[model samples]
Target: EYWWWSLFIVLAGIVLAVVDTLTGTMGMFGDSGLLGGLFELGVIVPSLALGVRRLHDINRTGWWLLLVFGFFPIAAIGGGILLVSFFLLDNFLILTVLGFAMVIGGGILGLIGIIVLIVWAIKQGDTGPNKYGPDPRMATSQ
Candidate 1:
């Protein structure tokens, strides 16, 4: 359910973006619409809601979505900042060693989080009720 909804929302966002570019209405009623924040109502809100529901279907907390999406980019940016600080301090060798370590560690963590999310999203959901809620399968049958 969420997978499909997300796909559709992403497609809609792309369409709106293209229309905005062609029409010179760079912010109207869509992703970045003339209506300002109202634009995100169609794109980000539904997508986020679907994503959260998707996580719930797998018997996981919606917070997992935040960790999955945010962990990598946040960690990687922090690592880059650390590396730049090291360079500014004139610690060349420390910059090389620690910067390399930071980047690699961030990448590893990011990859791990992505893999976990992939598995959680595709893996068969819980048979009945586990934690998040009742099995979607059962809900459909009734």
Candidate 2:
């Protein structure tokens, strides 16, 4: 169920993006227009909710989603700032190396996190609810 809902959300986002691009309302790269922004705003809460539910289904804490989604982006952003600082500070060698390390490490870890989530989503949820709540499967049947 989580996998299916996640797929639907992704597909819907893709379709909206394509429509926005084709209609010249937004650019494919960066120039987001009203429609694109609205779509993003609309989906953000639901996407998070779905993610939390999915995590719950697996008997994992919803907090895992935060680590999965937040850590990498924050690291990458911090790395970017460092990289920019290195340039502004007359090419500090240490800053350059540290920035590169953070950015690359963040990206690699982010990819691994995504892959792990994907695998978990594919697996069966806890047999009879180890925690979080009752079995979603059982709930639906009644």
Candidate 3:
């Protein structure tokens, strides 16, 4: 598929992220913070769409994109929350075990999700037509 476009989109996201960071550091973007949010949204939307489309090219559903990026953050956050709960609660063994379990489970899922995305990102597109549709590479060449 359009690997180049995917690469470009990733780079654009990074560049935009850096710009947003700089803007936040300098406090120059705006007062409402809408611009900064827009900058963030700019990256999120394109990255998700690109990932999903690329997955489609490889005969995978767009949901895989959500699975990859979405699961990690959710897991990490859940882990963090559990970790915080461990500290706040008066109980020791029970809370600690539960908290650590959530944290570890979330971490593992996060890692797996990352690995899946990486595999998807680097792996070549389908050789010919796939469940998603006709091969973009083939169509373009023809």
How does each model score on lDDT? 0.70, 0.76, 0.68
Cα RMSD of all models vs. native, in order, equals 4.7, 2.6, 4.5
**How many residue pairs clash (N, CA or C atoms closer than 3 angstroms) in each of the candidate models, in the order given?**
5, 0, 0
By lDDT, the candidates rank as 2, 1, 3
Over 10-126, each residue of candidate 2 has an lDDT whose tens digit, in order, gives: 787678777887888776446655566677788789878888888888887888777777759866786876868676877677777777777777778778888988887777888
Compute the lDDT of residue 114 as modeled in candidate 2.
Answer: 85
Write one digit per residue (lDDT tens) for candidate 3, span 1-142.
3467767766765676576566664244443243555655566776677778788877889887666556556556666666666667654666566656766776787689878877877888889888888887774653
Model 1: per-residue Cα lDDT over 54-117, one tens digit each: 7787778888777766756755775776767666766567656666666677677778987887
- Stretches off by above 4 angstroms in model 3 are 1-37, 140-142
lDDT for residue 135 in candidate 1, whole number 0-100: 81
RMSD of 3: 4.5
Best by lDDT: 2
> Which of the predicted structures, 1 or 2, would earn the higher lDDT when compared with the native?
2
Candidate 3 local lDDT, residue 67? 65
